[model samples]
Target: MTASTSHRETTTADGRLSRYPVFLRVWASQSAGAVADQLLPVAFALYAVQRGAGAGTIAVILAGRAIALVVCLLAGGILADRVSRPRILFTADVLRAATVLGALLTLNRLPLAALGIVTALSGAAEAMSRPAMRSLIPALLPTGLLERGNALVAAVQRSATLIGALVGAAIVAAIGIRAAMGLASLLFATGAVAVLGVRDSVAGARTRTGVLADAAAGVKAIRRRPWVVAVMTAVAIQLFAGTAPTMTLLPLVATEQLGGELGYGLVLAALATGALPAIALASRWRPRRPGVVGMLALSSYAALPASLALALPLPVTAICFVIGGFAVELYFVYWLSALQRQIPAEVLGKTLALDQLSAFALLPLGYALAGPAIAAFGVQPTLLAAAGLTAAASVAALLVPGVATFSDPVGTKSDPAGG
Candidate 1:
C-alpha cells in the first residue's frame, strides 16, 4: 500500500460504515447515478427494436457508445487528478441528464443517427465520471477498508442496474420508452443533488502539474509496478475471450433453444442474481493474494461457454452463468480493492483509466467477431472456441510472475514464490 494510504485508514468505532458519513453519502449518489448509467443501454436496445431498427443498427449504436467511453476514459483520468473528482462527476452527471432528456423529447421519432449521438455522448460523460468516482473512494476511506468499501459500492451499483433494468423494462412496456428516459434523467439529477452535498477530500488533491506531466506520472506508476500492468493485460485478454463472447453467444443460443428474447434476458439476469450475492459475500472475505486470486477466479468464466458448446439445457446454461457471475464479482471486488490500496492516491485516477483502456479496447472486437463466427462456423463451435480461448488466457495469467506472486499487505503468502 502507498504511504499515504497506510496513514489514512479511516474506520468506525465499531466497524459501522456510519463512521464515514460522507463516504456513505457519496455511495448513495453513486447508486443513484448507476440507475441512469444502466438504463440507457437497455432503453436504447428496446427503443431501437421497437422502431424497427435491425441488429446491425443496434450494434452500431452500442458500438458507438462503447467506443466513446473507451476514447474518453484517459481524459477523464487526467482530469480526476487535476480537478475535484466530485465536481467532475457532478458535471458529467448533469451533462448526461441533459442528453437523456433531449432524447426523451423525440422518443418515438428518434432517428438512428440521433440515437447514436445521444448514447455516445452519454457514454462519454460516464467515461469521465467512472475514474473520478473510483479515485474518490481511496481519498475517503483507508487501505484496510478498501475491500469492504469497494464491495459496498459495487453491490449498490449492481442492485441499481438490476432494479433499473426491471423498472426501465416495465416503464417501456407499460408506459413507453419516453417514461424510461424520463426516469433516467431524474436519477441523474438526483445524483447531482447528492454529490453537491458531499464534503470532498479530492479538492486538496488537485495539482498545478501540467496535464501531460500528470498523465505521464500515472503511466510511470503502472510501469514501476510491473504487476499492475501484467494484471491489466490478463484482464484485457479475459474480457476479449470470456466476457464478450458469452454476452454475444448467450442471446443467440437462448433464442434458438430456450424461448427468445425473454429467455436471453433471464439468462443474463441469472448472472446478475449470482453477482448480487457474491458482492455481499465478498464484503467480509479478504483473500491473501487478492490480485492472484482474482486472476484464478476469472477461470470460472470458462463454464458458460463450455456449457453452451455442449448444447446443454437452458437451465444448465443459466446455472453456468450464475456460477460465472459469482466468480466475476469476486474477481472485480478483489482486483479493484488491490489497486485502490496499492496505488498512490495522486495517480490513482490515471492508472484506473489505463486499466479501463486495457479492459475496453479489445472487447468490441470480440463482439464484432462473435456474430460472424456464429453465422459461419455456427454457435456451438464459436462458443467452444471462446471457452478454449478463455481457458488459455487463464493459464497464461498464471505464467506471469507478477500475477502469480502478488499478495496483500495484511498478508499471507498463498503462493510458494511469495513465501
Candidate 2:
C-alpha cells in the first residue's frame, strides 16, 4: 500500500492515547532533564564570568562541552541499542547531577580548566540521554499517536529552554551561580528519580557485534533508506548555512539596528513565542506527505536572514524571527515524528546519533567562519547568502526519491524482535 493510504488507515482509534501514564512519567523525566541542561550552561557562564574568565576561555569551555558531546554520541547510541533505555536515562541524569555538584564543590579552588572538564562530562551525559530518549517514544506510543507525542515532546523542550534561561538568570542574580548550580544538580536528580517510574524497558535486540561493526550496521540501515539521507542532508545544510550564521549575526543585528541587548532579548523571546503555536498546530495536523511539507516549511526559515539582510525595522525583524521560529519548529516536529515512525527499532539509536552528529559537526566551523565571511563579504551580502542557501537546500531535498512519502515502499521490513 502507498504511504498516504497507510497513514490514513492508522488515524482512527489512535487519537486518544491509552498508555498515557507511562508517557507522562517519561515526559516529566525529560522535562526535568531538559530544564537542567539549559540551566547549567547559563549558570556556568555567569559563574565563569564572575571567576574572571575571559571571553576566549569561556569560548574554549563551551567548545570543550560541544566536542565531548559529539565524541560520546555514537557510543551512547550503541549502548542505548544494547541496554535498557530507562536505565540509560537514569544513569545519564545521575552523571549530570554528579558532574554539576562535583564541579561546584571541588573545582572552585582549582583553575577554570577543571570546571570545563566537568561541564564536558555533563555534556557527554546529555549526549547519552538523547538518542535513548528519542528512541523510547515508539515503545510508549503506537504509530498513530507518535506525531502528537513527538510534538508535545518538542514543545516541552522548547519551553524548558526559555524557562531555564530566565530562571537561571533570576536564580544567579538572587542567590548566586553556586546556588543556581546546586539547584540544577537537584533538577538532574529529580529527572533521575522520575525516569525510574517509566516501566517500559525499551531495549532493542542486543547485537553481539563489536562497536565498529554495530556502527557499520547503522550506516547500512541509512543506505537502505534514501529519504533519511535526503532529510538529514537538508538539515545539515540548514544548520550550517542558515542557523549558524543567523546566530552569529543576530546579536550584532540587534545592536546595530535595534537597541542592543534588550532588543536582542526581545527578538529571541519573540522567536521562542512563535514556536508554541506551531507546536500546537503540529499536534493536530498530520500531513500525507510529511517530508515534502516539512522541507517546505523549513524553507520559510530564510525569512529571518532576509529581514536582517535588508536592514528591516526592529518590529519587522522580530516578526520575521517569529515566522522563522514557527516554520522551523513545525518542520522539526514532523521530521522527528518521521524518524520515529520510519526507522527500524533495532538501528534507531544509531541513526538518531548520526542525525545529531551531522547537525552538530558543522556548527562550530560555521560559527567560526561566519565572522570572517561577514568581514570579507560584508553583513548584508553574507546574510543574503545564508537565506539563499537555506532555501535552496530545503527545495533540493524534495527532489530526492522517497522524500515525498518519507519512506521506501519496498525496502522497509517489520520488526520481528519487537524492539
Candidate 3:
C-alpha cells in the first residue's frame, strides 16, 4: 500500500486503540533503543577502566560519541526530509545493530581507541534515527492529539531512562562487557522491527535542492515564524546555560555533599521518578497557550538550586528534583506540540533536525565547564548561577512579542488529508 493510504486507514477516530497503537509502537521501539544507548556507555566505560585505560583515554572514548553527534546531525536531518522517515529510521537501526555487534565481538581484544571509533559510528546512527522519529509523529496522529502524543513520548523516554540505567548496570554485572553489548545489539534489532511496523503517509514531493540549501530553507522557515524562532532560542539558552548544570553537575554535588556515586544515582532517579506523574497527567491535558506554559514551566528551574543550597536531607532533595522534573516535562510537551503543528510536513525533518542541533550544540561545553566552575566556586553557588541563567532565559521568552500568545496552528487549519 502507498504510505498515504496506510496512514488514512490507521487514523480512524473510533478505533479501539484511539490513536494509541501508533504511540505504543513508536514508544516501544524508542524505549528499546534508549536502553541500548545507555547500556553501551556504562559497559564501555567499565571495559576501558578494566583495560587499565586512564581518565584521558576514557574521556576520549566518551567524547567520540559526542563528536559523531555534532558531525552527522545536519546530514541526518537532510536525509530524513528527503526520503521516507521510516526507511531512514530502519536503516539507522540496522547500522546501530551492526556497530553494537562489532563492539561485542571485539571487546576484549580491541584497544580503547578502536572501541571509541566503533562507538562513534553507533552515535552517528543514533543521530540519524532521532530526527526521523521526531518527524514521524505529526504524520501518525490527528492535530488535537499532538500534545498527548508528545507527552507519551516524553514519559516513555523518562521511564526508559530509569529502566535502562538499572538494566544496564545489571547486565554489566551479570555477564561480561561483551555479553552486555550483545544484549544491546538485540534491543536495537527489535527497535528496527517495531519501526518497520509503523504506518505513515508519504510526504508531498519535495523540491530538489543542495544539502546546504535544504538546511538553509529549514532555518529560514523558523526565522520567518516569530513564535518558532523565539521558542527555539529560549530553549537553546535554557538547556545550555541553566538546565545542563543541574543534570550534568548533580553527580558532582552528590559526591561533594552526600559522599559518592550512590548518592548521585539516587538523586537522578528521584528526578526521573518525579517526571512520571507529570507525563501521565499531561497526556490527557493540553495547554491552551503553549508558549506561555513553556515559559512558566522553565521558571520552575529557579527553585531547585535554591532549595538544594539549603542542605536539605535526601527526601527533601528528592522532592525538589521531582518538582523540577514535572515542570521540565510540562514545557517539553508544549514544545513538541508547537513544532508538530507549525512546521510544514515537507520540511519537518530538516526543521526538527535544526531544532535538535541548536538545542544540543552547546551541551558539550556545558558539561566541560561544570567541573571547573564547581571546583573554582562551590556546587551550591554554581547551581544557583545556573538557575539564575535559566530564569533569565525564561523571562526572555516571555518578552518575545507573540511567543506567549501562540496557539496550535494545526487546530484551525483544514486537514491536508481532507478527512
Predicted model with the maximum lDDT: 2
Question: In candidate 2, how many Å is residue 308 off?
Answer: 4.3
Query: lDDT tens string, model 2, 1-419?
Result: 33422543354444775556787778889888888787776666555655666444454455556667668888888887788888889999999999888877875486775666876799899889988888887767777787788888888887776677667756765688788788889999999998885655445445567888778877777776777788888888887788767765665566567875446556665676678889999899888887777888889999988988999988988899888878888888888877766666777788788878777776656656776787799888998999999999998988987787676656566332222
**Per-candidate clash tally:** 1, 0, 0
Tell me the TM-score of each prediction against the true structure: 0.89, 0.84, 0.81
Worst 10 residues of 2 by lDDT: 1-10
In candidate 1, the residue pairs with backbone N, CA or C atoms under 3 Å apart (3 or more residues apart, or in different chains) clash, namely: 9-142
Best by TM-score: 1
Instruction: Output the TM-score of candidate 3.
Output: 0.81
Worst 10 residues of 1 by lDDT: 410-419
Q: After superposition, how far is residue 402 of candidate 3 from its true place, in Å?
A: 2.3
lDDT by residue (tens digit), candidate 1, 1-419: 44455565543334566777888988888778897777676666656666666545665666666677779989999988778888987899899899999878876576774777887898899989989899888788766677788888988887776666656655665687778888899989889888886756657746577888877887777766666677777777777766666655554466568675456556666676778878987788776666566777788788888887887887888899788878888888877877775676777888888889888878777666756777788767877778877767766766655565453223422221110
By summed lDDT, which 10 consecutive residues of candidate 3 come out lowest? 410-419
Candidate 3 on 29-107: residue-level lDDT in tens?
Answer: 7877777786676566556655666444555566567667767887888887787777777888889998889767766
- Please list the C-alpha lDDT of all candidates, in the order they appear: 0.74, 0.76, 0.69
Cα error, residue 379 of model 1, in Å, equals: 2.6
Q: By TM-score, is 1 or 3 better?
A: 1
